[model samples]
Target: MEARPRVAGIVLAAGKSTRMGRPKQLLPFRGRTVLECVVDNALASRLHRVVVVLGHEAEAVMPLLGHRCVTTVVNPLYGEGQSSSLKAGLGAMTEETDAALFLLGDQPLVTADTINLLIAAFADFPSPIVIPTFEGHRGNPVLFSRETFPRIEALSGDRGARGLFREYGDDIRSIDVRTPAILFDLDTEEDYLRLLREFPAV
Candidate 1:
């Protein structure tokens, strides 16, 4: 019998958040910082492991994750871009990892259900890429098969996971989802306010 693939979750929390000013990872949402919420949610998922990459204000942001069940690593090259954080997170994963789910630290609303849903799909129909989409719009927390990690590591600049979708072409897969939370990320003051106004109950 084929052994089950070990999937890991990688949270990119190292951005400078130049648009939001200060560190959005430390911003509060639902009684917790955005990084804490995101990491907690990822930890609640069925992934084999969860790794959080931090930079910028890593000192302030990391302690928030101290209580959570996650492995936090600081990306010294975080100033370069999201790709660097992605690389840093992947490096922290174990050799047995079969795929990695790349998540945003600012997207606290992306629930564990969504992460597990993607993992389930990838388990049943393994692919080079598994992206969550709302209606026709693509969203964050893309799952990359271990085969693509090398390609992703080679990526440079601020561009993150999305660019590889176009590069891989036919290898990409999609899991059509119902929630817009997959698209929500705290990138600015207005974005944070919108998150408050949009999902007040959560």
Candidate 2:
């Protein structure tokens, strides 16, 4: 039998957070910075590698990951948008990586179980894109197969991987996640407050 493809975790944290008026990744959450919490969850999962993409307030956020085991990559053109960070993260991955799970840094609610479950689904039914869905709603930390990496790298602006869904919708595999955290991300004060109120455990 062939060796199983290696799955890596990519955390997109380079956003400027203009709406939040501050770096949301540095915001306090469960004894650690918001970005740290997200990275930690990915660490606790089954990914073979983890990389955090930084831009905007990279100076401030990079310090928080000082003791982290994940590789940190800086996107010089982050102001151009999320695609820059996505490309930076994917570029930093080792050649052995077969697929990558893209997670939002502002979304600290994602659990390790969800990541492992996504990996499990990918193992059973590998596809170009694997998104988590809750109650018919799609969510992130989206997994992209190696075959689709070239197109994703060619992506420009803030579009991220949305365009891929349109092109590869039929080939996309959806894994049903039980938690709403997959869709919850902190952007403004209200979103952060609501996240805390809705998920008290965090």
Candidate 3:
């Protein structure tokens, strides 16, 4: 029998949230912090391991994850931008990890089912990148194959891995998902309110 790929889930929660004027990762959502919800989803998924990269208000956030089954890492260069946090998370991956599914801390609504869908696609297609699409629009957390790690590691500033899609267009696999949560990442107070209104219970 073929061995299953070891995929890790990396939650990027190191952003300073300058736009929201607060750490969105610590925001309350469904009885837990936004980051907690996102991390919980990742923990429930099929990924072999989970790593959460924290920065900005890491002191306050670290306490919340003390009991969870995740390896947390701090990104001192978080002020640099999303790329730094992305790199921080990637640095925690083990040698056997075949791919990484990058998730956003403020995107608490991205369910385990959505992440599992991406993993399933990678299992079959083994594409350079696996992205989720909602009604033809692409969204995160995107799956990056180990082959693209070097290019991703070379990234800098606030840029995420999306830029690589253009260069690897032929090797990208887009999976259509049923939920719009893939596109509803929280960025401001208005976004938070909207999320509460839509998912008051969970």
Number of the top lDDT candidate: 3
| Backbone clashes (count) for model 2 | 0
Q: Check candidate 2 and list the clashing pairs.
A: none
Q: Give me the overall lDDT of model 1.
A: 0.88
**lDDT, candidate 2, 67-131, per-residue tens:** 98999999999999888888999898888998999999998889899999999888888888999
Candidate 1 residue-pair clash tally: 0
Top candidate by TM-score: 3
Summarize candidate 3's per-residue lDDT along 1-202 as a digit string, tens digits.
7787888999999888988989999888889999999999999999999999999999999999999999999999999888888889899988899999999998999999999999999998799999999999999889999999899899999888998999998789999999999999888889989999989973
TM, every model: 0.96, 0.96, 0.98
- The TM-score that candidate 1 achieves is 0.96
Give candidate 2 misplaced runs (Cα > 4 Å). none
**Model 3 residue 181 lDDT score:** 91
Q: Which ten residues in a row have the lowest lDDT in candidate 2?
A: 193-202
Total backbone collisions for each predicted model = 0, 0, 0
Judge candidate 2 against the unseen true structure and give its global Cα lDDT, from 0 to 1: 0.90
Off by over 4 Å in 1: 1-3
Model 3: runs farther than 4 Å from truth? none
